[model samples]
Target: MTNHNYASRVQNHNSSIIADLLVQSSDPQNISFAGGYPDASLFPSADLADAFQHAVADNTPAVFQYTDAKGPQELRELVAARHAKHMGYPATADDIIMTQGGQQAIDLLASLFLDAGDGLAIEGPTYLGAISIFENYAPKYYEIPIETDGINLAILEQQLQANRGADRIKLLYLVPDFQNPTGITISVAKRQRLAELAETYDFYIIEDAPYRELRYRGEHLPTLQSFDTHHRVIYVSSFSKILAPSLRIGYICASPTILTAVAGLKSAADIQSPNMTLDALTYYLNHYDIDAHIANMIPYYAKKRQTMIDALHKYMPSEVTFTEPEGGFFLWITAPASLDLNAFMYDVLIPKARIVYIPSQAQYIHGDVANSARLNFSAVAIEKIEPGIRLLAETFTNYLTNHPAE
Candidate 1:
């Protein structure tokens, strides 16, 4: 029998596999390399507490009331200045709109551009969170392949050229800096060409770069927005990786015309991001040195990344290969195409070894790939890194050995 009536969109919207694994991770015995979480030890607790206290004490009744839908002007100005300095682009307060997080920024853009059956392009093995959000609109997904440096521009251009009518993609989503599941960064030449393609094809690019500032090893490349001669790039980023996730602060940088529509959608969605949090973040940025805080965090996360990579090198089998990311919370692993790592996890790895990592099935829109996984390094403790990876490596080797290629 059917339950109460529900919207058709509800059928397509389902919870992320990461969410289910997060619940499993609550157990003390289970070791998880699954969720993409930042280390809590690095958060600036004291400074944030002071900032919140100052915001409430100074703003009083004013802070308690409803603020602008675009968020407090002071915070927007600060974000614009910081973005301009770091991202090698010119921005002003008018060009910025704060959101619940970068996740909301992406959703808002999807709302602005997508309709049912509209074309949407994303990196294959993309961030799972983005997959969940984009699914709500039921857009026709073009799962573009990723290269060692970034998304395959050649293939993407072909798709753009071929689909020039009603099926042409309206929006393109990318995590150019140390992409979430793959840990690959797009090259400078591709960034320029991507911007040019967007102009020629008449589509907008959503540059969702939450991990851009976490680089531990390479020189910083310019943001996609910097290369945008036309206002076709909507840049989204967050403080969740650099600061605390609970803060729920992120911003969208785009042309004022675009932001006006996004702000309306945001206002309808949640009214606005919490006012007190915005004020507190503003106060924190004013008084504290976020750059220095980021500097301190680099070595801490860098150590964890190195530990995970070393463990992989020491233990992984010849058939299995993994990425060596310069900077990011996660790295990817690929096995023989026929291995079916998802089934191996449920039937063998989780029950026998008490180990968990995100399988490649959940990473793609259609969930067709079956022999890869995304392993997060920053969340697990330094002591558990080697053991978790070692156990995983052993399990994989044994499983592959016992069930040779069919």
Candidate 2:
């Protein structure tokens, strides 16, 4: 009926693999765990309303106008301060480049550093958004396997050594803390090695740490950026997880040169982040203690995380194995190798049982198992978790019984 003339670069590019599932899961009747969505009810609406009002009153006409490409200086300083205070990462305000979201930071970094055919190593199963954005550039890839602890560094070393001179590999990208889809954090030892690998391989590490502060259990491991003696790690995080997702505010901390380049790239993409949001975020950060606010939300999510884990253990088939995440919204589940997870999710679960999950097919760059899914626990209500998870477990067990993994 219309023009299908998309650019050649976009031929293989698609909105994450879960896009369809997300759309289906959006139905009011469906118990969906398809999106990396934080609980909407938990947002500090009253606090933010006053914060925005204060920002608008304080800044007047300027608040309505455009902002700097690197975002509000106050907000940037706060981002840097949070890192330095929490993780002991040596990030300064000058090193910060704020973006529309952490996703934009990734895009800006990709544009600034990656060229066509340039090698960009990433965790085999990384953030879906990162894969979609990076695919547009068509950079050669080195997919490292992820372990319970984190990315397998041995494979990373082997890849780096093998591809040492072939291509202009500019960077290695990863979601180190409470990584998406899997909900696993990289180990402290791996953090040091990752920094070392960056130094030895002469490639930068893009540490996408959107959920670093969301930890409800276990010790907070040092970030990869903290281990970097040299300016090799470009650390990016967002307010989406803690404050609000709709704010569309995230900031990157790296070397001044690196951030300068990111700012330039960001400017080319979108002149700057929205002035209103930036001002509001600045006011919120200055006025409120975000850590205390985050702490308040933790008990709720902690209980929900346990709820889902318990439900999975009790109701799911023996053939299924699910992750026991310390914190974070997602839990990775692997079904028997025989079943097509999408078939189970789309045809069986969504239609029959009104349950949904993001299948593992897209998560794996290359892995043995395909019958796996990323189930999000935070979006569902505390009361709804058990019933929803029961439906998921029963449906899975029945699916396996009818069609064994033989």
Candidate 3:
């Protein structure tokens, strides 16, 4: 072994449970409900191909040149316009800083704010990707419980108040719209309360909105940033879900002061985002009706979402409870605390049922997760849903009956 004192962050770079599940599920023999990827068929490949040709054919030098550290200004302006149309927020391009993707936005924000042992707040069962990024920063996480309507505000207020004076919590990270793993959206009332709490407690709110554009049924709700009179909300959105993920384009809207720090961090990290990809995306946005494209894609995902919901209802045991997410690509399922999802998966699901799902233990920062899991319906085709879910339900039912421990 070499004698080198690696930074403590390297210690936590171990293989994650989610990563393991993804690897195992990659086997074609297993019917995987693990990945959160969008349906490949929905990508506008032909249109994007045409746009890329026109973008490169017209201006080679400009397209290949380095972009602004904060990303292409015109693309930021176009994102601002889209925000205006969908979110009713008139944030200027000055408030936006582009990043590699939403994941980079999170990492940049963490780098800008977090120091070792800094206090941060997050939902208990939150986005695994966010947890993966934030963990490396070594923040003291204040995990708040959540409900279907959204985060439990009473508990959140208690935590905020508890950490108020010298504790000085740095950021309250959240995925307010169609949150990952749980598929829960914060209500308007709770959203307002969050804004007020952030102002009162002197903490920033990282409002991640990757899946807001993928909503299928619910009425459009105002974002936390919209209610932030104190400018405490950092609004993040990504083109990964809405457009070509390979473009690796996403943006964050926050106060100029916060964005300045983020831009500096971005420059240090990557100097600038890809100019050619930004040009292609800009050309596509200018020439194409992306809203119309997403509109066309809705029914397909909506049908898939419903099929998963229906399959769960028809096949699952009575003790098995799950969320009926109106939109987005996930369905969160929970069983009794005694049921160990990982053990169940190894012993029953894979060997007998021949199905795989993302166990929720790794989804939490705290290590008490016993009976929760996440399933994705978007990647699997329409025909496979019934058989996979039916088999999974049967396996679970048989296991509960046969085994006495859980």
Each prediction's total of clashing residue pairs, residues at least 3 apart in sequence or on different chains, is 0, 0, 0
Error of 1 at 18 (Å): 3.6
Encode model 2's per-residue lDDT on 237-354: one tens digit a residue.
Answer: 8889888899998888888988778877888898998888898888988989898999999998899999888888888878889888888889898777777787777778877888
Candidate 1 on 1-406: residue-level lDDT in tens? 1234766665545464666777766667789888788998999999999999999999999889988889999899999999999997799999999999899999999999999999999999899888888988889999999999899998899999899888799999999999999899999999999999999999999999999999989899999999998999999999999989999999999999999999999999999898889999999999999999999999999999999999999999989999998898989999999988888888998899998888898889888998999998989888999999899999988988998887
Q: Candidate 3, 353: how far from true, in Å?
A: 1.7
Per-model TM-score on C-alpha atoms: 0.98, 0.96, 0.96
In the range 1-406, model 3's lDDT, one tens digit per residue, is 1225866665555245766888878888899898888899999999999888978987688888876788778888998888877876778888888888898999999998899888888997898888889888988888888898999999888777676554558799999887898888899999999999888888899999988888789688988888988989998888888886888988889878889989989999999888777778889999999999998988999999999889999999987899988777898899877898978887788888778987877788875786999899988888999889999898888877876552
Error of 3 at 256 (Å): 2.0
lDDT for 11 (candidate 1)? 59
Worst 10 contiguous positions by lDDT, candidate 2: 10-19
Give the number of the best model, judged by lDDT: 1
Off by over 4 Å in 1: 1-4
The true-versus-predicted C-alpha distance at residue 106 of model 1, in Å, is: 0.7
List clashing residue pairs in candidate 3.
none
Q: Per-residue error at 397 for model 1, in Å?
A: 1.3
CA RMSD, predictions in order: 1.4, 1.8, 1.7
Pairs with steric clashes in candidate 1: none
